[model samples]
Every structure is written in structure tokens, then in C-alpha cells.
Target chain A: MMTYKSEDIKKMNSIELLKNLYQLNNATMAELVAQTSFSQSSVRSILKSLENKGILTLQNVDQSSGGSCPGRYTFSKEHFQILSVFVDEGTVDLKLKDILDNTIFHKHIVCSLNEELENIIITITEKYVVNCISIASSGVIQDECFYTDHGEYMTKHEIALNLKKRTTIPIIIENDVNSMMMSIKAKQSCNNLAYIYMSETGIGSAYYVEGNIIKGHQSFSGELGLLPYQNQTINEVIASKSAKEVLEDMFVLILVAVAVTIDPEKIIIAMKKDNNLSLTKIKEGVSKSLSKRYLINLEKSTNPLEDGLDGLHYLGILKLFDLYTDYNREKRNG
Target chain B: MMTYKSEDIKKMNSIELLKNLYQLNNATMAELVAQTSFSQSSVRSILKSLENKGILTLQNVDQSSGGSCPGRYTFSKEHFQILSVFVDEGTVDLKLKDILDNTIFHKHIVCSLNEELENIIITITEKYVVNCISIASSGVIQDECFYTDHGEYMTKHEIALNLKKRTTIPIIIENDVNSMMMSIKAKQSCNNLAYIYMSETGIGSAYYVEGNIIKGHQSFSGELGLLPYQNQTINEVIASKSAKEVLEDMFVLILVAVAVTIDPEKIIIAMKKDNNLSLTKIKEGVSKSLSKRYLINLEKSTNPLEDGLDGLHYLGILKLFDLYTDYNREKRNG
Candidate 1:
């Protein structure tokens, strides 16, 4: 359904093959075939085309493994710089990464998002020859065109589209939780998945069901903090810390909700890199009533921030590939 | 991805085509074409084949007002009898339905489940020549091979498989919540959906993500009542009526859980076809915290039981079509 309409029977397109190869890094043709389920002939032809275009490189693996082995193809193209941006409350975090995923530069600047976005795009793209700009922001992304200031009811900030006008560099923006979830999703496949980020000051959530992300009707699905608990909303309780004693209790409720309703195969609860009583308490409380089947699916992550940043990086790199592939397609058509 | 593998580029199969035609009873070729997204040629070929097999019949339309319209084809095979059984506590509800979904016989029999299952199957089949047996039961159904009484940890009841041995008819079994969900799903397509059935005595939930039911690991999902909630489990609280005043409050939490995580396009709250204090309270509480983006997705249904029965009917009828399809395929191969 990602590339083809669900009803239309379709072949694995070039982007899918590229995505698999990029994730696999240095992998033989056979490995790419297995990862993407493309026929050997199809994989070979695509690999050959990209290799001829200098977008891919092949290196022979040592026959030290039992017998003769096929050559491994690496998807690295270090020339392409991916500019990844994460919009914080009063700051924007920026990172420039190469196709090999090396962080060339990382910066955090305190500024209003609406005012600084245009400047950020110009300043970074000029400095780094950025191939793609991917933003991970916290709000409802309207068809990835604009980020609504507060949920779906607030003033619409046309961040992605406005930035696209500033430069030819492809601009891809998504909800923060969605980006974090996508980062994890890119690492491995989990049919049904829920990613929750909880910390001292903030909470975020993302969901994946079957194959695609569970983006709500208005793309405002992962607004978990807005959910009601007692007289105060979940975000209020978190910010006030008035319900600190029952914070674990509230987390239990949230986990149970996701577990029972979404029925994900795995739910990753990412807390801050540093944590205290919350994780243990949440797990213990959940274990009390949630059956072992669901309890086992609950996992704790200490790298929530890293996951979010990595998500932006992956998004930028892949989007860069999409641009390049489109260009290649145009070239072939011509 | 429903019938075809995600990786496989495949055509609209026979079963899918038949399902549309069956659901769109007395529908024209154009209607089936739209529903299944099959080509005119493909639909015509499949219809012709089934017509040759005497499973389908085409009829002429009046077209009184407009230009001559296409003939409508009906899928009313009166010979097929479907035995739909819903296992209730201290009793079993059985209904014999024809292919056109007409209930020919209905009964409520008091019996111990494990002890009387065999007797019930033998008696029903002997008297009626039932073509298909569909069961809507509570608890975990593992691979549709066995129904575990408690959860995944409980003793396995090889109901479907065992009943299949005693009778040649295809046996279809699903969790009651799933059956209700499938029933709604058959009526219309909602990409992300949650179905909640709330009654004075019991609570059940089912989820649809992307295109399929979220049947968690161990197929022990939709165990909503087991979720942990403030000292007592949800089921315990429901059973004792100890928290009757706060029942709607609890339900709001459940709804929020489903809304935020699954991010369904619609969440159907099916009450027991009666008015009470809960529904209003739930809507109010949810409205208070959830913004218009999500609150609009909440829907009320007074026909939960009907949906479940309809689900079983649809499942049984479609499965019968599958059997006939396989036989036809075999004949062609031979």
C-alpha cells in the first residue's frame, strides 16, 4: 500500500529495493533479494543501474567464508549531505549527516520556529550543500504540508511547504513521535508497534499497525498527553508533578490502553537516557494485571532523544534517495 | 495484504471477487468492478465461470426511467445452510441462516460447554445438513485451531478442528469482538478502527489497523476487561459494580487509550441497544480532553449483537465460497 494502491497488484519498485540495500549496507545481491523479496533478476538489474550511475559501489568479499562468495554492494554516497532539523519549544536542533550517516555538524539554537525556519534552511543549505531537509516537529502535520501550532485546532504553520519554496532541497516533515517510531521501524519490522516517550518534562507517542503508521484522520494521532485523567489532562499532571505519587499509576493506564486497544506486538516505552523510580514502577504496576503476553511486549528505552534524532537522520537520508531516484527516472525517460 | 502477501505482486483473486458480488447482492457487473477494483475482463471471466458452476445467476433490470441499465446478479444460493453458534454463559445461542442471511432456525440451549459441544455439533448437523459452522466465542482462539478458555495459558479446546472431524462442513470460529468488528468492516471500509461493546454485565473490544484486525501475539488480544485499572482489574470493577458511578470515567480512559494509540479514523462504542448514564458521561469526558480532530471519530451503536451475528454470517458464507472455489480450481487442474 505504500507505493501501490491496496487494490492494485504491484511489483516492488526501485525505492523499496534501494531502501532494503541502504539498510543492509554492504550486502550481497542474494541478501538484498531476501530482504526485499524481489526476484534475483530484478535486484541485479536495479543494482547494476545504480552502480553504473555511481550511486552505488560493489566490493568483493573475501572467500574466507567456507567457499566463494558473491560481491557485496554498499549504498554509501558520502557526497550527499542530509540536513535534519527537530523543532523544540524554543529551540531548533540541527544536524548535517552524509549518506554513510556520519554527523558532519550538530547545533542547537534558541529561536521561535516560525521566524527562524526560513533562516535555518538558507544558513544550513548554503553552508553544507544539503541534499534533503527533514524536520521532526511536535504537532499535527497536515498532510506534511503544515504543522498546526496546537494540535489540529491551532494556527497552521506551513513549515515544510514554505521551506520547500526557499530551496530545491526536498523538505520532508513529520510529527516527532512518528519520526521516532519510524526510526525504530526502519531498524526492524514489527507488524503492530507503539512507541511512547516519557521524560521529566515531556511525553510523546507513535503507533504502527499492520504495515503503515497509524496517523489519525487529521494526522493528530499520537497526542497522548492530551488524554484526560482525573480533573487534569495527562500533560497537566506531568507538568505539575502534583500526581507524582500516582505518575506510575497513570503510565500504567496509558500502557494498558495501548496494549488492549492497539494490541501491538511490541510497545517501546522510551524514557530519558537517565531515569529513576518511574520505569520500575510502571513495569511493576503493568505486570500486576496485564497478562504476561502483553507484559512481555512492553520494553523500556533509555535513548528516546537519540531515537528521535536518529529518526530525523534516517528520514532525511531516505528522502534524499527518493529525490535522486526521481532524477534518475527522469534521466532514463529522457 | 489481506489475502496476498505484502511482497507478492498478485491479481484480485477469486475469493475477493466473490465476496464483493455476494455483499453487493443483485449488483450489476459495474458495481462488482468498483468494489473489488478488478478489471472488466477479470470480473466478467470470474462471473462467467461461477455462472457455469450454477453458483450465480444473472437477471434483467426494468430501467423504467433511464436508458437501459445493466442486469443485476444475485447471490442467493438457498441450498446452503449456515450454523452460527455464539457460546454464552450457561447457554449456547444457535442460529441456522441461509446463504441470503435469512434465519431459518434459532435456539438457546443450556449446557456445559466442553461436555455438550460434541452432542450439539452432531445433533445440529444430523437434522439440518449444515453447510458451514461458525462460532462466536469469548477468549483466545489460537490459529483458529483451538479456543483457550482463559487466555494463552489456559487449556486448549480444539473446537473448530475437532468439530471439522465430526462434520465435513467448514468450521469458522472467531473471538466475538473480532466477529463484530469483521461485521462492521464488511459493511464499509475504515482504515483504522476500534469497536467497543459495553453492557451492564460485560465489556469487549476489537481493533482494525490499516486493513487487518490487531490480533496481538498469542492471539490473546481484545482482552479489554483484563486491563489493570486502579487496584481492581476492569472486569472485576465491571462485575462488582463497585465503581458504577465512575464506569463512564473508566470507559473514557479506554476510549482515550484507543484513540491516541490506534488513532482510528472511527471508534464505534456499541452499547446494549439501551439508554443509560454511561454513554453521555463517556462523550462528555472524552470531549473535554480530546480535541475536535479525534472527538469527531467517536460513534455510537445500539446494535452490537446484530453486528456480531452478521459478522458470523458473512464469515461463514465467504468461507463456503472459498471451498467451492478450491474445488473449481482442482477441477480445472484435473
Candidate 2:
């Protein structure tokens, strides 16, 4: 754990300045001074330090008169690379993206239950200079371990430990639904949102509150399938549904429950591309059951698999930056 | 909205220091300097400012040898009073508590459907010199206004606005379940908790994540009555059940749903004193339904009404302190 001290305040201020520069993309000394309350000398000193650390680059754009202008500071685009993977029941999709959002590699692999996960990860790492690895799967993850609700993979932590031994980079294993939620949160401006994921196997949910995903105490949040309804669980009803109206009714009940409890700004239903369901019908059915004041917007996800992969990539990049920040803090303290 | 500039940083540091002093109750200058990373001179400067503002008092503690010793700084208690009220369907319980947690007055009044809420509030305010008022009711609260789920009250906001005209103190209206949750959070150390408030009217829930309450987008995050279960909602099942076993079964299903979704560390069932159900049976029933990994501790609230009132008082005091901080900042800027 890190404790904030008076000395750390200056370091924190520098980090804030660097974050602003990252967000700004390119800024001159005068623009930076105008953007922050820090003195001009403080801004210059911090920028020079970042430049020395190879985190930022300074470039001078000359005017038509040929006179020297203040140099512009820009964050390094290719400072790190992240390997993100989304694992389904029988298939795995992998993508390696740079800090600048460039996709360098993409691959999909179909694997059997007995396949060696460690060897597959090692082979992928040998092909790229990855700084962090993030994998999304359908399960409960805690303390770098995975526990499946219905699966045969018993040595999940052993696989994670084996991967850790193969590389010095950090490994983040997250639930697939949580990954999709993060992806949606990254793209939307709403502070409170809920993502409902429906698949042939079961239905789950992920809540986004003020930029943070609510994973709950044991990482078992969003298990909507466990909800008992109509003398049976939601999963049983959905699985046994014979008519479209029955399915729509079940959805309406779920939506009404979500609206009345969470009252999110938007409810996103994430399904496979092949599962065609009209958002309009579902929204209309839910609206009739709820009061006007409690009506919420409902939409369908464009691409859930891609969103899950993107969420993994985003989380991996965040971990890489956190590592960088911690390394710098350690260097400063030393 | 507030932005953090260099000047605000100084003010934040002062607030942090003051909070530490408030938590510590009393400490010498050397002790304060040792506790924080700030310099001795900085500590002295902040303490002197607080002393001059009458927020803290300095006292000398002599050594055993009868010689002069260092002075101690203590936060002044009883600086303000909070008027807390819990409004039920037909009755209102009120209490006036000081900043030091002392209850100065308590009253219970029965109200009819057509009674003017502003007059009741005015009658209470006339009995005390209150700095703030906090009301906990069974409704959806937003923007300091109440909205009942099922009631005859048409203009809840108008009533609140009218009360504002009669009293100059700050007023806060909150959901009763949220208040109970807040009170429990204040007294416990659990980071993740869920409180299930069960009454004859309906069943509601409150989720506590980290140090903040999850109020959702519209402050309707815990209306469990809307959840569909077993050909009816949880509220419907509980309200219609006449046997203890039936109620236990319903509780088991609800607990399983909560466990699979939120996975809270502890689930506190807040029921009226007369509604006696065995905790062991409910725990056993839920554990049998869920896997061993999802087992959670279940407890009963000792006093729901007191907790609600205390929560109101606590929130009112917090708002008061926030107001003090903002006022000081404005003064400094002026």
C-alpha cells in the first residue's frame, strides 16, 4: 500500500501534469501554463523531466518567418503493448494492440478441453513484445484465480501461475461480462449504466458506477440467471421458451426489475450477432409494465465479442500505465 | 463542480489535517507532526488557524515533575445540532441530536393523510435551535425532494420547499432503507455490505460499496419489491405467506439471488421487532441452495428505526462539515 506524504504531493502534481499532457496530445509551454495553475518554470521542469524519461517528446514548429517557436510536448505513442484475449467455451480470440490503439496482430483459435493453456500463451508471447496480458472468460475471478459456475477447468490458478512464470508482465483475468461492461463504459458518457449479457448458456449483468465496475465482494455479481421467476429460474424459462412472446415477457420482467432497482440511465443487452432480437419490442414490453417515471432506455450491443476484447485491451493498457507510475514513484523515492 | 488547482490543494491538505485531528480527538503538536508528513511549522500553523476559528481548543498538560509541558489540541464537540425525522406511513419519529452524538429531544407524532408536513416540521423546529434537518421516508428521493411509491401525497417537493421557507437550515430527504444502510456502515468495518429491509409493506435493499452507498441513477437502486420471483415478486410472496417455512423459502431464494449477484460480505435483514424468523434456518436454507463458495454471513438489525434516525443525524453532520469547509474556502478566496 502507498501512503501520501508531503513529499509525494510534488510527485503527484507532476503525474497530474503528465496526465494532462497525455490527454492534450500536443501542447506548447505557453498553452500548458495557461491550462494549469502551476508556474511556467514548474511546467517546464516537469516537461523536461518527462522528456528525459522518454515518456514525452518535444518538437519545435517553425513559423513562416523562420523564427524559433516554443516547443510542443507530446506523449510517446508506442511506449507499450498489450495482449488481450477473450476466451469462450471452445474458442479464443487474441489481439495485440499498442498504446496508440494500433492493432499489430489478431488471431482466433479453437481449443479442446485438454489443451495446454500455458503452452498456447507462451507461443503467443514469443511472437510479440507484450508488456501486459489480459484474458476475459466466463467465470468468477478473484486474486488472480478463476472459478467457473459450470466447467471442468479445476486448475485455473495453476494456469495463471504458469503464465506468470513464463513472463515478467502482469496478467489480469476478468469475467467476460465485466469486460464487456468496461468496454461500454469506456465508450459512453453515462455514469450509471448496466449491461445485460444473454447467451445460450445463461444471462448475466454488469453495473457501471461512476467509471468503476461493480464486481461485488466475491466477483459473482451480474448472475441474472439465478433469479427465480415464474416458478423457475430465469435461465430455465429462457431455455425452455417456445414462443417469441414468452421470451419477450421474460425480458420485460427482467427489465422491470432492473429499472426499479438499479434505475440505470441505459440498459444494454449484449448478445451474439446471430441471436436476432428486436430492442424495440423488448423496450415497449418493459415500458408497459413500468410507470412513466421509471421508464429507461434499452438498446442492443453492436458486437459483444469485440467489446469484450476491447475491454481486455483497455484494462491491460491501464495496468501498464499504473506500472509505469509505480516505477517512477519508486525511482523518485530511491 | 470543483477543480483542483494548486490553491485548492492547500485547502484540501488543511481539510485532511483537520479530519485527522477530529478523528484523533486530542493530540500534542509534536504528535500531530509525527502522525502526518507535514513539517512541524506547518502543523502549528494549521492548528493555530483552527484554534482561532474556535474549531479546536488548546490545553496544557503538565508533566509528572510539575514543570510545564506541551499543549494539546482537541476538536470542539457539540458545535451544532441536527433535527432527524423518520416518516413512516402514519407516524413520524423525531430526534434532535448534537454533534457529539447526544440526543437532546425525542418525539413521536401520528400524522393523517391530509396533514400538512410543513406544519409538523415547523412545530418540531420551534423546539430546538437546529443547524440542519434530515428526513428519512419510504420513497424515491432526488434533489432534496421525496416521491412516494404508493401514497396520496401529490406535491412532496412543494412540502419540502414550504418547510425551507419556515426554517433557514439545510434540509435533506433520504430513503429510509438507504439511511439504515448508512447507519450500519458507520458502525461496521465491512467494505462490501447489503442491507435487506423487510416490512409488511414491501422489501427493499441497500448496497454499500467501499465507503459510498450505491443509490443508482434515480435513487431507486434497492427496490426489491420489483424483483420477479416464483410466479410473483418477492414482496408478493412474503406478503401472502402465512407459514414460517414459506417465508424462509422466499428468504432463501432472495438471499441466493443477492449472493449470486452482489456477493456481499454480510447481508443484514432489517425487520420489525415483532417479525421473528430464525436466522439459522434462513442461513441453512440459503447455503443449501448456493455453492460453498457463495456462503455469506446473515445477521439481523438490532434496531432499524434508531439506525435510520442515527444515519440521518450522521449525514446531516457530514453536510454541515462540508458546508463549513466550503465557507472557509470562499472566505479565503474573498
Candidate 3:
């Protein structure tokens, strides 16, 4: 089966053979020739080139089938590590994963908003030789810098520049909600998706159209909290509401807006893990406002934080693959 | 010098040569070779093929460059005509446009919602041999059928099927608001655009993001009239308002919603030609609600009917091009 990682790999024909090998983890020359459309000699040449670049290792696995069993090739596991970080208001979640998306290290650190984020990142980098780093945070990110809703210690670009002084690796900065939506898109096959993050502080939204994120003209497409509902904005109503009836009414109103405006195939609501919000009243209210044909399938996120981290990991893997392809191209051109 | 039509033409190499010939009307072979990237032999071959297909005529022109004079080519004047219809509640506006989008014939007829649309279409089609027919109507269109706010005599599919039985030409059915947005997109270069059509009866919105329309998962996007505001839906408020102050406030509220959510580069408001609505109060209200950073440049449409017709004409041209390309490909393949 083709994964999201393979989807990016298939864009460049030159990398497709190596990408298939990497996805298979361990495959014989005969197996690769059968799997790919490339001729046997082209497959052999690509494998030899990858081996010369130290990207894969070839070894004989068996000799029972013929006079000489085809050798098995495996991608270099030690060279595909990625460091991912998910930053929130007062906490940071760190993860390290391999090319196959296997988590090698996971840790959670509780710190104040004013804590030295650079020091924490530097400490993690000192412990691992990651090919790429990705950070997902809450706010509007532009020009490699993040502008949070409240405030932050340093801009993402500043931190990236600081990290660059110590290590020479690519770093990517993405919005948290955008990251969560990306994770959902990577896992699902739906064309249009609206991921609404409703929490105690505020409500935000991110939309996915045909597997691409809709950031609007200024990257503010899904600022649902600013939507006015019944005399107050959506966030204000959510924050002030203490009665269950009011909350249900507010959810219904917001859902109606999303339904009529976006008409997404699926609506994924991301709330706090401890929050006990029922979908019954929300669905009932939406049904009253919209026809059943326009209704969307509603779902609650099981682990939004994990989803964000997985999304960051996937982004890091893409960056790493891009770097790998660029290096291969430069070597060939030179 | 490349307009949107030229942009579409450049996608297919074969069409680019023919389109350049059409755009230039009559251009010498030397001028064509100098202006286009094709080799002289290639240009001659394309011109020969087009002439053989009865699309263009070649004529000798006097030398202006003080060298050997080359023959000029012009597209056949009578070969490309399109029938366009804009359907409203109690009337239908019909137009016939040539290849250059010049109106050849236009008429506005008083027709009830329950009128037999087929007879009217047949009446017009009998007078002209059109290459394509395009219908733009006020409704949500899906699978060639339109679902209107109120009952109509025939769904768009029924009308299209009826027309197809009479003529073998291609037919396209598009939402009116979507057509308006398409027209705006063709004339402008903005990456993100949101067009809102506000009349005494209802309001509809259409969004253009990165040169594509956002039709949502169920093709129900941009249903702005359903948005609830001030104890009622937007349409109800628009209907109940007799005072100018209330109308201004309502427009401001809707503008603010669009401003913060979509962050569009431009917002076009389409009102009735005689409506005495001013933008000063609407702008002030939006500025008060949203930060200046999120304020969008607002403008009003000068001639909405013309814009809608222009949009339909452009769509019809695209359909005609598709049919032309398909025919050529089938001939070659066979």
C-alpha cells in the first residue's frame, strides 16, 4: 500500500525506485524488478548508485531458489532520524521518529511561557543526530516567525537561526491547528475536511480542500472564533457559557455556519481530553437548521496532541527526503 | 500580453498556435514565426492543418518590413458562435457571442417561473448555429441540475437534456454567483477573492481561492443567506429592514464575518443597479469590528448582468476548446 510519504516520493521519477525500496524496508533485486516498471538494468543501476551514496545496504538473504539468490537491499536506518516538537502555551511535547514513523524517543516537559525554548531544543539536538526538525505551535506563522495569540519568548525564525549556529539542518515551522488537519488528511482519503478545535480558551478551525490546506489570502481562513453568534463572538459565548443548554445552542449555531458555508464531508471537533461534550444536542440543533443532505459526519479527536506530533513528523520526513533528493541531484550534476 | 484566454490556450501546444492566429485576427507568417516560439516549419504545418480544418483563411499582405512578404492567416468569422442564457425568477436574459466575446444578438424576455424553457431555447437556437450553449442560474448546481431557493418549472438537467436532444453541441450549467466570481477572476489577478451578491430578496457568496472555486464537499458552499444574525437569519433581516441604518449595520456585520474568516484580498458587493447603498458606513462598521490588518479592499460591480454574461461566454469558449481538442485527438488517434 502507498503511504503519504510515498506520495511525495512519486513526484520525481528518479527517486521512485529508491522510495519503493525504502518503503519495502527489505527487498531483493528480483522483487524490486517485479514491483517497479523500470527495466531490470535500470533498477540494478539505481540500486548501485544508492549503495554508493550509503543510502542502502545489500546482502544475500537466501540461495535456495537458484544458483545465486538475489541480494536484499535495506535503507540505512541510522540516517533517517527526525526531531519533532509541539509547543503550547505552557507545555512542550518532544518526539523523535525514524523514516518509517516509528517513535524512538518521547518526552513531555512542563515549563512557563517565558522558559528558554532555545536551551531545551539545543539539549535535545545534542542527544540525537536528526536529519530535520519541525515545530508546531499555536498562532499565525509568517516569514519563519510565529505570532501567538497572547505572547511568546522568541520568534520561530530567531530560534531557528540560533539553532542553525550550532547545527546545520533544516527546520520547519507550522501552525498547530494546520498540523492537526494535515495529520487527519494524511490518514483519511476525504477531499474536503473541516477540523474545528474547540477548547476552554477559544475555538479555531482549519480546512482541507482536496488534500491541501486552505490558508486564505493572509493565512487566516479558519478563524472561527471571530465569527459573531447571537450578540457576541463565538469564543466569548463559549467562554461565558456555564449552562449546558447555552453550550449546546452555541455548538449548534457554529455547526450551522460551518455546514452552510463549507459543507465539508467530515467535521472533526478537537476539544480538551477531559471535556465531556456530547454530540447529541449539537447534531439535533444542526439538523433543525440544515437539511439532512447537507449534514456532515461529526467526530471527536481521540488524541489531538498526538495527531499534531505525527503531522510534524510527517513534515520532517518530507523535508529530509527533499534534502536527500537535492544532494543526489547535485552529485549527479557535478 | 498573455490574457486569461491565452493562459488557457498555452496549456495545449496545438491550441496555442491556433489561438495566437485567432487573437491576432490576421498576422503574416513571418510575424507569427517572430512572435511565437514555434519553428517556421512547425508554424506552417499548424497553419496548414487549421486551414484544412476550415478554421482559418490565408491571404497575402503587402510587405511592411522591407523583406519578402508572407501570407496572413485569419480565423473564419462565421464558425464560432455561442448561445448564453442567464435565468432569473421571472425573466430570462439571452445572448449570442462570437469568438471575441462580442455580443452578436441579445434579448430580454418576460417569462414566468413555470414557462416551458425548451421552446424558448429551440426558438433562439433555430436562428443561429452555435458551437456551444451555457446557462447560468441562481441556485445550487450539482450534476447539471439546479436546486433553487423556490420552485422552478424545470431543473437545469431537464433543460440541458432537452436542449441536447435538439442540438448536438455541448452545454454547460453553472451557478449564477459562481459565474460572477469566475468573471471577476478572469479580469483580476488576486490570489483570493470573495464575491457577495446582495439584493432585496437574498444574499449569496462565492469564494475563489488560488484560481479555483471552493464548492465544498456537497457543492453547497457560499450559502451566506443561511447565516444567522441578530435573532434571525441574514435573509430575514434583509427582508424586514426598511430603515437605512439597519441595512448598513447588516452589511457591515456580514463584511466583518467575511473579513476575519476568509481574509480575501478583495470583496466585491453586487447590489441592484438602482439601490442607493453607500460604502462609507459599511466600511466604518467593518473597521470597528475587525482590526485594520484584516480589512479587505471593498468594491461594487458596475454591470452585473454584463459580467455574468461575460463569465458564461468564457465558460462556453472553454467547453468549445475542449470539444475541439477532443475531436482533433480522436481524428489523430483513429
| lDDT per model vs. reference | 0.71, 0.72, 0.71
For model 3 chain A, where is the 10-residue window of minimal lDDT? A1-10
Estimated TM-score per prediction? 0.84, 0.82, 0.79
lDDT string, candidate 3, B1-334, tens digits: 1112222332354565655655566787777777676777767866786688676777767677567666778766566788888876678888998875567889888763233776777777787877788998887776666666442243444577667778777889888887877777656557788888876677888887765777877766787777776767778877775577776788887776665455678888886664667787788777666545555588898567767887788677666655655543554688
DockQ, per model, reads 0.36, 0.40, 0.30
- From the highest DockQ down, the ranking of the candidates is 2, 1, 3
Q: For model 1, state the Cα shift of residue A120 in Å.
A: 3.0
Error of 1 at B322 (Å): 6.0
Ranking by lDDT: 2, 3, 1
Instruction: List model 2's recovered fraction of native interface contacts, to 2 decimals.
Output: 0.51
Q: Give the residue spans of candidate 2 off by over 4 A.
A: A1-52, A57-75, A111-127, A149-154, A236-246, A326-331, B6-52, B58-74, B111-129, B150-154, B163-168, B235-243, B326-331
Pairs clashing in candidate 3?
Answer: none
Clashing pairs in 1: none
Q: Between candidates 1 and 3, which one is better according to DockQ? A: 1
